[model samples]
Target: MSKVDADTQSKWDEQLDYKKLPDWKDCASILNKRCQYLEARDSKQIRSEQCVKTFNKNSSTKPTIVNPHRPQTSLAANQRSCILCRDLNHSITNCKKFLELSVMDRFWKTKKLGLCLNCLVKGHSVSRCPSSYKCKTCEQAHHSLLHRTQPADTNSGIDTPSDTSGQSTSAATHSAMEKEQVPEAQVILATALLLIKDSSEGFQLGRVLLDSGSQVNFINEKFANSLGLRKHRKNVDIVGIGVTETKIKYQTQSTIRSRYSNFEISLEFLVAPSITGYQPEASLNVSSWNLPSNLELADENFNQPSQIDLLLGAEAFFDLLESGQIKLGEGLPSLQQTALGWIVSGRYKSKYNTTKKASCVANTLEVGLDKYFEKFFEFEEIQGLRSIWSEEQNECEKHFIDTIKMLPSGRLMVQLPFKKHPSCLGGSYDIAFRRFLSLERRLSKNASIKSQYSDFLKEYERLGHMSLVPNPNLDEDHYYLLHQYVLRPDSVSTKLRVVFDASCCTSSQISLNGILMVGPTIQDELLIILLRFRLYRYALTADIVKMYRQFLVNPSDRKLQFILWRENEPTPIQTYQLNTLSSVFG
Candidate 1:
């Protein structure tokens, strides 16, 4: 018989009414009911730390009922058997079965074993329960006492005595009659991802628990086996919590890459049984790396992962923490001032997961020089640009007319004509002309810009830059049509100039400048001056007014410089050809 049963029988012998004490058969029935109730209750309550979770199945060979780490041949001859389940591996107080029993059953179990009444568990008395739950009736923090149920007159303020002993119960007796009602203890498990490495392989991801309270680091045997790590045969004692005895565990050395930083440190870890509870429904042949969860920001339940393959204890945790690779939360209570109210809450920052994605979107239009240049390169293929220009042509023409009206009425306003109608190949050149015209009108509002356009043309005409092409001079080849605009309308200077494009394509898809020449290039005058300074220690510079127009061009080449011009809408467009090498030469 168990020591509890023997103790219960001895207590019955000391009772004043020995004949009224329950018989052995009745006691057995009560014990059976107690076990059944405890089992039912335990099925309802879930323990997060000790809860069963499914893991990678490739590591398992077959489904087994016993502890996977414990050898089948191992004997527990010296271990004390639990009074509730008769298990030799754990004590009665620590038995999961007994701990789930109801308050009444728990009380009887303790009383029968001649144990404390306050804490139904053995080895403690009424003064100490170590429970955090407060009383549901009296608002006190003690187990609820079973008060005698007595029918009383509504007018009377006292409860009639209901005890069969026919005597008044004292406070001490009432306290002993209280049942056990202690809540399960809560534990904080800090889990993170660590990079563990073996001799023959690169660093691999391993789920680790940062336990600063533990004296040493630990790695599960299954995890180490998965990594194919070699273990040293060291018979080291692993002491558990409280007065629990130590067990032998093997030791192994591994290099762990920190989750927060690039630091990799060598650590000695004890290889022990897997700390995770097993799930029976999990398969036995799955092979896959346990990837860390990619959590979104709004996921409220930021609990640790289900499985922890390693335990990084004080030896490694503190060192990592001191090195700024890990950090811990403050244990003190704090309040935060928010728009709603003062919120009392604690925050924990994990070293492994620094940030979470709040939202995602596809950005195809990010602005950059390369992106703009890419669009510019694709300008020929863009059909929408043609339609856009078609819609805005009228507005562009109206703006151009308004700019012409704004200039002095008597201003020559000569129209540049072409020797022949230029090919508007794919009409891109027309689009370019419309853009130039619109931009010119918009820039004409600035006084500095208006002067630049007028001054450049005045200089060209005054220098006899070009002459009217003779009516008899018959030229079959069409001259390229050019457009002009202020180079920098924003700049305020008398010399601020306008640039006329000479690379415009003709109807034949060719530019006059493009076909004119392609050979040795002219030396940069600045570079020439610098070279002379190096040779002769002297340099000279001068401004040659209309030097390009003064340089004579061969008369035959003048045909290629033909242009069309008109003073106003009423004047007919007239043709002219350049007789000077004044314009920007190709």
Candidate 2:
């Protein structure tokens, strides 16, 4: 919402019929009421006789519907296609093609920087994974330092200050063999021997890993074996991706952030999700592992430490990120316990898409409440309502009816079928389920409360009394106004009062937040003014009817930058648009 839009909304609200208006100050308070249904009426009259409360309307015993202008819609275009994914004109943020695509465009680029967090998988950067160099320092919390000292023996090449065990000069020469330690970085990167300590369930295995990107503890066969850990049970689900090895090198002594001598290193191993083709969920038990002796021998004979229950590789990393348990260690806690790196940053992926199809209709029938059914099902039955769909989806009609009949959650899922879901994405089951649930709006439509919210605002102006009404279903007008403008964080609805006393003029400035309000007017007339004050600001007063109800964040994240209105608030403001922000009450 813009300042002009807000101001315009105020003007029209002032011009509405104040004599018949209701008393509610805002829409939220009105909708918050718990009323379920109102008695039916046959005609359009101010006085309603069938309602629970017999209200007066001039002077007549009449029966009439409370709101008759519910179906009013303005003429406008809806839904823009996604630009990157190209599947839709709308941005990937609002595209429902695949959540993975959304994540790729919205999160990976800006978050990953140059790291390859998704090296084990497809479509991602590497920076998302843990750094391969945090092990050598002393302050490392878990592992304790222990160095082996050899007794003095010139023959064995064990030059020590004390007496040495007697041995042949040849044996001494063999003993003199120096164990050149491979740098921890080289070891992690060069080797692919992720441990599989417990493999009793032949072919089924689990392991431990050290993924700094992870939050909570998880277990995977590859991660377990990376630390060279042994387990009691076999074939147990490791619960995470395989632990991979990558090397690190430290050559400079002065390059330390906290404090420590920097040694040269290289990396190779990996910690990754163990899912077969990204299938099979691992049952993980998160328990802290006891640390091994922390030995930081300047000599190249030691290994680094790693520790984590299920060190989520690139794939599983974001699942548990919000929980916030994955951490980076300061020093050598133990091998496989601590991750070494210049810094550790988490990478997240998001895929959210919603495509509503009205031209695309489904075959489902709606029936009125039954005697035994009314006691059980208060709303219409799924079988009787008319459906404009094909034979395959007609089963959905029965499914919808049976759903509400069989399960309690079914009624809550009131599905109003339409050609709502677009056929695409190899057409997975998840899409089918979404299409099934899209049919519940009929109840609101029949109840005549679809426009209950907006109508109540208009009524408040007419009757001067408080009333509440239910919102419309998906195929209805662009309902996202509730979330985008009304409820979205930091939206205009937050800072400005929907209704004011007209005395205190505390003005607030608002932009579209990148959210385009779609499908405002199918005709030229203002269907009840959304904003009573202004018409157009920035010449943006158009709306699209087709909108993405739920918007997933974008992928690529390359051009990702959150425009901040002020300092101290570091959160990036990535706005997801439904279609276009041009739609407004003109």
Q: Which candidate is the best by lDDT?
A: 1
Candidate 1 at 314: error in angstroms?
A: 58
Q: Taking the tens digit of each residue's C-alpha lDDT, what string does model 2 give over 237-340?
A: 22222343222111111010111222212122222232121111111111222222343211121122222223234443232123223332432121221222
CA lDDT for candidate 2 = 0.25
For TM-score, the strongest prediction is 1
Model 2: what TM-score?
0.15
**C-alpha lDDT of all candidate models, in order:** 0.46, 0.25
Residue 390 lDDT in model 1? 24
Give the alpha carbon lDDT tens digit for every residue of 116-178 in model 1.
Answer: 443233544444433334333443533333111111222321121123344564443333323
